[model samples]
Target: MKKMFNYYSDKYLASWIIKFLDLIVVFVGFVLASLLRFNFEVAGMSLSKLLEQSLITCAVYLVIFSLSKTSDLVMRHTSFTDIHGIFKAVVFSLAILIGMDVFLYEGMDYTGVFLIPKSILIIQALLVMLGISGYRLAAKSIYATFLNSSSALKSNVLIVGADVSSLMTKSTLLNSSKHSIRVIGHVDNHPKLQGKKLDGSPVFQLDNVINSSFLKEKGIDEIIISDATLGPAQKRAVIDSALQYNIKVREVPPHEKWVNGELTENQIKPVRIEDLLGRSEIKLDSINIQNELQGKTVLVTGGAGSIGSEIVRQALFFKPKKVIALDQGETPCYELGNTLKKLPEDIAAKCEIVIADITHFRRMQQIFSKYKPDLVFHAAAYKHVPLMENNASEAVETNVFGTKNIADLALRYKVQKFVMVSTDKAINPTNVMGASKRVAEIYVQALNSQQNSTHYIVTRFGNVLGSNGSVIPLFQKQIEKGGPITITHKDITRYFMTISEACNLVLEAGSIGNGGEIFVFDMGESVKILDLAKKMIQLSGLQEGKDIDIEFVGLRPGEKLYEELLAVEENTLSTHHPKIMRAQIQPVVSDEVKVLMDRLHEKVLHGDDEGVVGGLKQLVPEYISKNSVYSRLDKKSSQAYA
Candidate 1:
C-alpha cells in the first residue's frame, strides 16, 4: 500500500491521478446531493432519469475543469491560486447547469415531471467545490508528511523578516521535498509586530541585545535573513550572535531576484563577508546618467575586465546609442562578445565589442576616429603591484602611456567627457603599478586643465571583492583545496567594494564631473586581510587553524601593510553624493607636465625601465618605492631634489 501511494504521489503522476479522482468526486457529489434533496427516498424520482442527469452534470464539470486547467497544477504544491482556479471552474459549471435547468425544467413542468431538482444542483455545486479543494489540500498535507517522515533530521530555522519575502521563502522551504527545514518563528525589529503571526509562525521582536543563550534554548538551528532593508551592521550582529550559538546563517536574496515570482530553496545562500561591509547602499542619479549617455557613442577601454565589463553592463541600462567595448585580451573580449549577444535584442544591438590594445596608440586612434565616441571611460591598465614591480616597463607602457594615449585621443576627437578609472594604490604609491597610475593621474589631470572641450574626471577606489585575480577568488581556491590560505602580512588591510558599486560610482562621476577632478569613493572601513580570510574559512563551515590553516608569507615586494585613499598633500571636498568626494590638490602646470610626459613616453617606448621609473619619481615627488628595487632611484631623486 505504501509503495502504491508513493508511486501515485510522484509529481507528474499525482496531477493526472487528481484529475481522475476529481471526476469521480463530481459524480459522487451529484448522487449525495440528490439523496439529500429527496431525504433518501427514491419513490418520487426515476432512478434512470437521476443517473442520466448526474452523468450530464459530471460531463459539464469535466469540461469546465479542462478549460480552467486547474488539474494541471502540481497537487503537492497547491496554492491559493490553484484553489481559486478550482472555485472558478466549479462556479462556472454550476452556472451552466442552472441555465439548462431553468429552460429544460420549465418544459418538463408542463408535463408535471422533473429530471433533477434545482435544489440538488445547487447542493452538488457546493459539494463539488469542497471536494476538489479539500482533495488538493489533503494531498499537499500528505506529501509534506511523507517527506518529513522520510527524513529523520530537520533543521528548526527562524526567519528574520515578517514581510512577503520571508513568507515566500518559508513556504518554498516547507514545500520543497529536497530541503528539511521547519520554520520555527519570525524575528522582526518592529515592536508593533511583536506577538503577531505569519502563516501560523509567531513573530518575536529582536531587541538590540542578541542573547545567544536564548536562541540556543529555542533550538534554532539556523537563522535566515530575507529582509533587504536590514542594514549591514544589524546583519553582522545577528550573524555574530548566531555563530556564538553554533547556529548556521543564511540569507534570501531581495524580492527583485526571486525566480518566476516565487522564492526557491536553491536561491538561499550562506551569508558572505561582503554583506558585513556596513556601507550604505549607493543610489545613482539614473536620470542624470541617462541624459548624459542616452543616444551618445561611448567608448569603454578594457571592457573585458571586471570593473570595465560591469561598467559596460550598467551603461546598457541608460540606453546609449552605442557602446564600444575595447579590450586587448582576445579570449575575454570574445567571451564578453558572447555575453553581450545574450542580452535582449535591443540592448545587444547597442553593444559593439572590439579587440584592440590601449597601448597600441595608432590602433586606438583609428578606433576613436571611426567611432568618434562622445564619452570615454579609460579602464585599461596593468594593476598587479608585485607583478608590475618586476615588469615596470610593461606597467608604465600600459598604465601610464595607455592612459595618455586614450586621454590625448579623447581630446583630439573632441569627446565631451573623459572618465579615468584609477586605484587607491595611486595614492601615496609604494609600487610600480601605483606609481605608474599616479603618473597617469597627473598627466590626465594636467591634460584636463589644458583642455576646454573635454572634461576629464578620475574616479579612484580600492579593491573590488570578486574581480578576476582578487584575493577573494584566491582564498576560495585555497579553501576548496583544503589547505593554508596565504596572506601577505598579518597586519595587512585593504578597502573592498563590490564590482557593481564601483561601476555605479564610475558612471556617476562621469556624469557629474565638469572638469579636472579626482573623485574618491567612500570605501567604508578597511578590513584586515587576516580577519577576512578567517571569516571566509568560518563561512565555509571550517574551523580556522584546524580545518584550514592561514600562513603569513610576509609582505611581497612593493607591498604595504596598509593602503591610503588620499595623498599627504591632498584633501577632499564634498560632492552632491554622499559616497563620492572630490580631492583638492595643487594644480598642475599643463605645459611643464606635458614636456615631462613627452620625455617619459619616449623612454617608455625605448624600454628604458630605469629612465621611466626615474621620470615618474621626478614628476611625483612623493613616489617613494617600498620593498622594491626602485627604492634606490627614489633615494637618488630625493637627494637630487634636496
Candidate 2:
C-alpha cells in the first residue's frame, strides 16, 4: 500500500493512470448528474441522440481540460499552480458548454438542458474537484500512516522555543512527510505561545512540560530548540528542562554557520557542550582592525589547534604577506596544510604550516632566523588544570621556560612585535597550569619593559569551545557511549569564546600592543559546567535521565569554581579591539630573573621535582596551590633542605 502510490514508483506511468482516472471521473460525474436530473426518462429520444449529446459534451470538456492541464495526473498534488489550472479548466469548460447550449445547439440543448439542469451541472463540477483532490490527500495520508507505524521511522520530539525559527521549523515538519520525527509539541518560555497551536501541535509552556508527569503525558521522546535569538543563559535553561524530562533535544546552528540564507536540514545539528558555554557574542571593531595586521607577516605558533587554526583562518582574509603556521602535531598540521592549499589559490600560497615545538629553544631560534617574521603569536601551552596540577614541573618547563625561550629568541632575532597567548586561569592562579602561565606572562612583560628591540605583549582569554581537550568533545563522546557524562562540579563555571572569535581578538590585540602590555579579551561571563553537560546530552538526541545520565565528580586538584580574567592589582586601558583591554599595571621584574632561570634549568635537567617546584615558587611569588597535596615544602631552600 505504501509503495504503490510513491511519487517515484513509475512516476510517468502513474501520471498517465491518474489522467485516465480523472477523465473517468469527469465522464461519470456528468452522466450520473444528467441521469438523476432527468429521472432516466427522455421523451422522443433514441439511444443515438443521447449518445451523440454525451459524446459532444465529453469531447468539449476534454479539449478544455487538455488545453489547461486539468486532467494531468502529474499535477495531482495541491499547489498554487494546480489550483490555477483547475480554475482555468473549469471556467473554459463551463463557458464552452453554456455557449453550445445557448447559441449553436439552442433547440438541441433545449432537450439536453432538461437532462443537464444548472443545479446538476454545479453538482457535477463539485464531484469532479473532490475526485481529483481526494486521491492525492488519501495517498498522503496512507504514506504518513505507514511511516508513523514503522519503528525505524518514528521519532518522538518536543520543540523548544516558540520564535520565528521554531515556527519555520514547525512549518517544515507538518508540510513534509519525509521527516521521520513526529512533533509531540513545543516547550517554550514565552507566555503568549503557551496555549497556541503551531501547525496543530500544542505549544507546551516551560512550566507545563519540564517535569516528569507532563513529559509522560506528552509522550515526548525528543526535543528541538529552534530559537537562535536566545542568550546563553536562557538557552542553558531550556536545555536543562529537557534533560530533567529525559527528552532528547536538537537545535539550529548559530548565524555564522548559516551561509547565504540557507538553513538546510543537515545544518540542524545536535547541540554540543560548547553551546552551553556563556560567552556573549563578540562585536568586531572593523575600523580599528583595518589599521592593524592588514598586510603584515603574522606567525602563529601552535597554529593547527582550535585557537591557532581559527587565527590563521581569520587572518587570511586580511591579505597578510604570510601566515606562518607552526605546530608539532602531525595530523592537525597536515589537515590544516591541505585546507590552506584549497583556499583561494592566492591565499593558499601564503599559508605555510611548519611542525615545531615551542619547548625547543634552538628550534624556535632557527625558525626565527629563517622566517624573519614581522609579528609572532606564541599560543602553545599545556593548559589542562588537573593534568597540569599533577605534573607541575612539566607545566613550568612548557609554560614558563618555553615562553622565556620564545621571548628571548624573538628579541635576539629582532622580531618587531610578539604576542603571547595567556589564559584567564593566569589571574590569581591556584593550579600549576595557571601559575605557570602567569609566570610566563610576567617573563614576557618583563622582557617587553627591559628592551626596546622587540615589542612583547600578552593577550589573555578564557576557554575556547570545541578545542582539543575541551569539555564539549568529551560530552559528545560520553553521549555516544550511552552513559553518564562526568562534570567536575554543579557550580563550576568558566568563561568561553568561540574559537574563531577568540583568535580574531588575539590578532587585534597583537596589533594594538606597543610593548610591555598584558591585554585581556573580554570573556562575556562564566557558565555553569553541569548545565552545559545536560544541554549537550539533550542536543545529542538522547534523554538525560533515561538515555543518558550526568554525574558530578568532585573538583579536581588546583581547579577553581570560577575563573578570573584579570589579576587583582591590574587595571585595564581601552585598545583597538573594544572587547580587549590592555593591562596598565607595570611589570615588576627583579634582576634575579636570569639567576633564578639558571637554577631552574639545572633542576629541570637533573629531573629534581622538589628543586624544580621550589625554584618555580621562588621565581613566581604569587603561585598558590588548591585541591592538591603537593604543598609540603616552602619557598626558602626547600630544594637544598630536602
Cα-based TM-score, every candidate: 0.90, 0.70
lDDT of 2 by residue, 354-439 (tens): 89888898888888888888778888788898887777678788888888888888888788888888898888877778877877
> Candidate 1: minimum summed lDDT over ten consecutive residues — where?
107-116
User: In terms of TM-score, which candidate is strongest?
Assistant: 1
Which pairs clash inside model 2?
223-248
Backbone clashes for every candidate come to: 0, 1
Give the lowest summed-lDDT range of ten residues in model 2: 72-81
lDDT of each: 0.85, 0.73
Q: Tell me how far candidate 1 lies from the true structure as C-alpha RMSD in angstroms.
A: 3.4
Q: After superposition, how far is residue 377 of candidate 2 from its true place, in Å?
A: 0.8
